[model samples]
Target chain A: MNTDWKNIDAASLNNLTLGEAEKLFGLEPNFTEEELKKVRNALSRQYHPDLNPDSGNIMSKINAVYDILKNEIKNRRNAEQNNANGGATDTSSTSSDSTREEPEAENINDNAGATDNSTSENTADEPEVENLNDNAGATDNSASENTADEPEVENLNDNAGATDNSTSENAADEPEVENLNDNAGTTDNSTSENTADEPEAENLNDNAGAANNEPRNENSNITWEDVNRIGVENLTLDDARRLFNLEEDFTENDLIDAYNRLDRIYNPMNFPIGSEEAEKNRATMNSIYGVYTILRRNLINRQNVQESPTREDTTNQSTQVSMNPTNEKADNSRNDNGDENSQNIPSADNEKNDGQTDRPKDAPTHNEKPALSTGPTVGDQIASNDTTPDPEPIPVIKSIPAKIMDHRKQILIIIGIIALAIAISQAINLTLVAQMARNGNLWHLTAGVAEKAALHAKNINLTSKLIALKSSYDSLSGVWTIAGQKLLTGNLQAILRGISAGSGILGLSCLTAGLIKKKSAAYKEYKKNIRQLIRDFNDLSYDEAINQINSLRENINNSNELSDREKQLLLNQLKKAEKLNRQFEDIDQGEELEGGMSL
Target chain B: MMVDSIITLANNKNYLLLMESSILDDSYFLGVLLDDNMEPTVDYVVLKKVEKDGVVCAQQINNLNTLTQLLEEYGSEYAENYN
Candidate 1:
């Protein structure tokens, strides 16, 4: 009756069931496909934008509604085909029934069976063809305006004829088709009623708390973002419940209902086998099951807790039983006098038994026992006196020092890298010196020496002869001539030997120095002493700090293995420590003198 | 003393003072000068040589006093003690 369907937004339209949507077209929820076509034809003709150009975007809304309803019809037919083909067990088939609730799930078979009866009734729909023709003939005058819908109506007629032909083939087959379509068309109206009663029945059960958790948004169009927002692999029970749109006051029934609806919505079969949409749906499906299982387990645990009395309650009951050693005898007497005392004397024991049984078992949070106790409320006192005294919190360093401490390891690693680089470079230099020796490339040095010797001779006032010698020496190559071949060879040999010896000595010295630095006890002792001295200085114990500094200085001076450079570094540390100690001593003396006098 | 020995050797002209080049890099020469087909014909040998700016620049290494001063200049006054 509310045909202003143009006012509905896409989101609300997506949420609409086939029954609600069919009502927008002014048709009953139980309308056949042929009747649905008739309704569409009538609605479109009345609201065609070309005919009613002033209706704004009414045509778009009509088209959107048409497309969505068409999809639902297509889905229903697919589900029926699947059922006929014995593919009803297909998990995807369940997903196609997304709008159906859990209570309707049981009626799927009943509805399918009832639809057989409805389809047989649809055979009577042939008489209604004359009315459809009349409506179609009325629209012929506005042929140009109705051209878009004409072909579609013809196709519907063809489909209806095909259905009629199929109906004539076999009554048994007709029922299956009828059941699927009938359930598809009238599912909302009939199933919704069936489900309403079922939910009430479920609520009446002791696990009524679970029934309250039924998801309110039953036919939501879940998207990829929604699936991602409810993360799949790490899907929590709460997130799963939220995904199902369940409320806080939930029961096992609510969880099952929510799971079924969501499972149908996220059926992987709805999307392409391996498409992004399918993957999203699969994740959602897995998450739904995951959440369902957790909630089911929690529900079971809760029910178990409710069914079994609390540990304290059991203990108290046992004590009551022990105190009343005649409980068995009393029970036997009560049974014997069941008709007499049932109306006369209301026993306190009977009242207590009734109170315990009637006490709320819905949640563990309810402190019903404290209220039942006639004495001082010990439970309330214990709860009121609950105090968890926490330990003192550590001081959080919020300054540059904290940052530096964090990077201390990185700083040490960098320093070690630099030291390694320097050592590698030094070793490389020593290798190059050895290589120079091995190559016997001492001719350059020989030429240099000769030139210097010539220059020295010149400096001693030997003049022209010395100058001539210097010029000859400076220009000399390492090549031998006939006159001094043996002499040049001998000189080259000696130079090579001397260079090899010098390089070997230099390499040995370097290696020994590295080994000594690492293994030297004197160096180690000096480093330890210096570090201790610095600590003492920081402590502000002037006398002790001064004594440590002196001791460190003595250690460094006595250290035979430390090089001059190492000794200098230690001495610098010593000077700083001595200065700090002196300053502290002055402060100490001033404090002492002040203590001796008035404040 | 080394300068006098070099002068006497040059004056006699029995020994030829020869060098490979007027330039020295990290590579250097330090010994008695010998001609091609080298023979150590002289009675004494030089222990040091100095080259600068791609030339046979000075006779300073020929003087022991100047050599010791150079070592001290580079902060090795205790050079013999280290050796």
Candidate 2:
């Protein structure tokens, strides 16, 4: 027997019946609870997957059989208790004789008789007698009808006790009895008294039906009401995946495919409208759609996280903020403009804009180029004119020609400083270029020497020396080739050196010209005017400062004494002053607004 | 009986076709066959509807490799436009 057990395969183990399971454990079918437990523990130790790696199938089978036996024992005990409680008068003899009847059959008879007697006599004393008689009659009839299987039932009864025998027989006969009862209850209207007497029996019959029907009951238990109660927001990722019959690693396409298949299967249009099946399918479809929506959102969010792992927190915050109506509008406007500043800025005013009113009319749109004429000139005006008024008298604005002639020396001096800086930088660059050229020449010489030495070694049959020299030649040859290419392509470094030296010489000449210009009479007059203008603007209010700067700029632009380049330089300074004044105004306004809001 | 037919059809590289849709209609399906000993083997088959005996029948495509090849060739385009 032990050798036979060892020879049994997984398939045989899985196929074990209750009788076979008992034999596998080396026990009789009528084994006591303690005996069953002892055998199970011993078998589990022998077949545990941890100790025996290939014992998974055997362990699972053992566990499965144990669960079935446990449930059977529990049901048998419950049945005996119910008999003792409900049919106490007749149970002493009937329990031993009718132990081969199923617990469900007994339960139905007990309930039915109790209901019948309560209806007829308004008393429950005779309920147990009636119940016992009904069950006995049914079992006797079934046993007679299934005479061919009587020996098997008798064998079970003799060896495994009456409860085990009943279980085996009931499993085979319960469905047939359930169907018979259903037909009798429904179509046998002629037996009105019987119907009236045993109304609860039909329900018990249904409850006792096969395990295969349990899944349908389970599926039907989920209703639209339940789905609504557990809203999409509350559904977990696992629940959604289970609904779609999908795995964790499923992609967006996989989710879509699952949804499509479910949609096709539960399509309400496939059923007749307003029918129960149609209503059920519609509810199922809605539930599926809810699941699909949740899973799709999860898939999208997962992909987004994977694509930008570094930006997850920022993305989540942005998504949360974007949910607000105000922020959503602001985001849409910013997105439409495609401006980096619009995206980067997180101001309340931007949120309030809603596609209009926020952006300046003259500001560039996403596609349009900045209007260059207005940009610098308007900036110059804003910087100069948007300042506070001064208590002191301001200097009168001069004509462009007068302003230029006055500051001519200062301008020349600025030009000389710029030239000197350029000359110094160019001299440094020229030195670096000369060093690079010398390095290239040295590399070229080394390449030629290595090539010749490789040839000399090869001619003398010095193999190792030749190989080493060849390697050096190869490396130096690459550098030499690059140098030769550069030389062929116009000796770029020499050209660079020449250009640097020429620039330095030109810078010296400019410095010399500027120094001569700086000693002129016009230079002294313009220097005083410029210094006075700066001192007056320093004490002025924002408006006054802006006005004075704009007037100065007009003078610079209109003056014939000033060249375009000189005029441009003066206007740029004005633009900077104007920007500074505007920024000061904005800061002051912001502070006032914040103070007001706080109050 | 169904298990016997499946095993026979599988060995012969052929499969049964149910000549009417009765709940099981899909691009892919899994069928479980329980032997006399109640040991179960699961097989995945692709379902294709075809006209057999002048009636629409869901024919089980038993060859997994063939199904995979076909899916590889056309699955993406079909999935994208299925809606």
Error of 1 at A263 (Å): 2.4
List model 1 lDDT by residue over A1-599, tens digit each.
56775565423443345566666766664456566555565554455432343444354455445543454555567677777888545333234345332212222222232244332232233211111111111111112112223333233223322112222232233222223223223223223432453332221111101111222111111222222222222222333333443433357445543443333234433333345433434433443443443343334334434345543443223212211112334433443443222111112233233333232343222111122222322222222121222222222111111111212222222222222222221222111111111111221122323333333334333432233232222122211111112223434332232222222221212222222335456655675565455434434466676677777788787877888777886686577556545644543333321221110
All candidates: TM-score of chain A: 0.20, 0.19
Instruction: Please write out the lDDT profile of model 2 over residues A421-493, one tens digit for every residue.
Output: 1221122111111111112111212222333333333433343223324223222322232222233234434
Q: Give the TM-score of candidate 1.
A: 0.18
**Cα misplacement distance, residue B43 of candidate 1 (Å):** 99
Interface RMSD list for the candidates: 35.5, 45.1
DockQ of each: 0.00, 0.01
TM-score of each: 0.18, 0.18
Candidate 2 chain A has its poorest 10 consecutive residues by lDDT at A212-221
